[model samples]
Target: MAKYVLTGTYCPDVLEKRAPYREAHLGRLAGLKAAGKVITIGPTRDLTRVFGVYETDSEAEARELIESDPYWQHQIWTSYELFEWIQAF
Candidate 1:
């Protein structure tokens, strides 16, 4: 399995809209965690962005996961970045 880091930037003035979608967003992460695909996930302290580390078959698979997220679909996440990561620990 390869490791990936995914980053999401919150949409402008969309926290209110994001509330309704938060549960499903979390549920998706939980499902990924249960499947052993997610290493860790959470929003930044300022709530401006969310980040996750995941183990997946490939970078494309990781990209698929993020693109399919409800948060992305609903436009709660305005931008994203996915990168292969090397965990030194």
Candidate 2:
């Protein structure tokens, strides 16, 4: 499986407003983990940037999976970019 990075910018206001939804978002991430689609997930040190690693055949698939996340559906995301990544290490 190829690895892809799903990067997105969060809506700070929405994030502050929906602090309670973090757990549900984690639950959805866990579902992806259980299904072997995601490798890991976390945010940048500044906390404004979010990114996740997906193990799949293509970037489009990764984008589709991320879009289905509750966080995305609930307007927690303000901007997003999908990339097909290559890891040399």
lDDT, model 1:
0.89
Q: Pick the candidate with the highest lDDT.
A: 1
**Can you write out model 1's per-residue Cα lDDT over 1-89, one digit (the tens) per residue?**
99999888988766688888889988989999999999998788887898989899999898888889888999888898988999898
lDDT of 2 by residue, 1-89 (tens): 89988788877775585587788988888988999899998777777878888998777788888888877888786678877789999
TM match of model 1 to true structure: 0.91
Question: Which 10-residue span in candidate 2 carries the lowest summed lDDT?
Answer: 11-20
Backbone clash count for every predicted candidate, in the order shown: 0, 0
> RMSD per prediction, one decimal?
1.1, 1.7
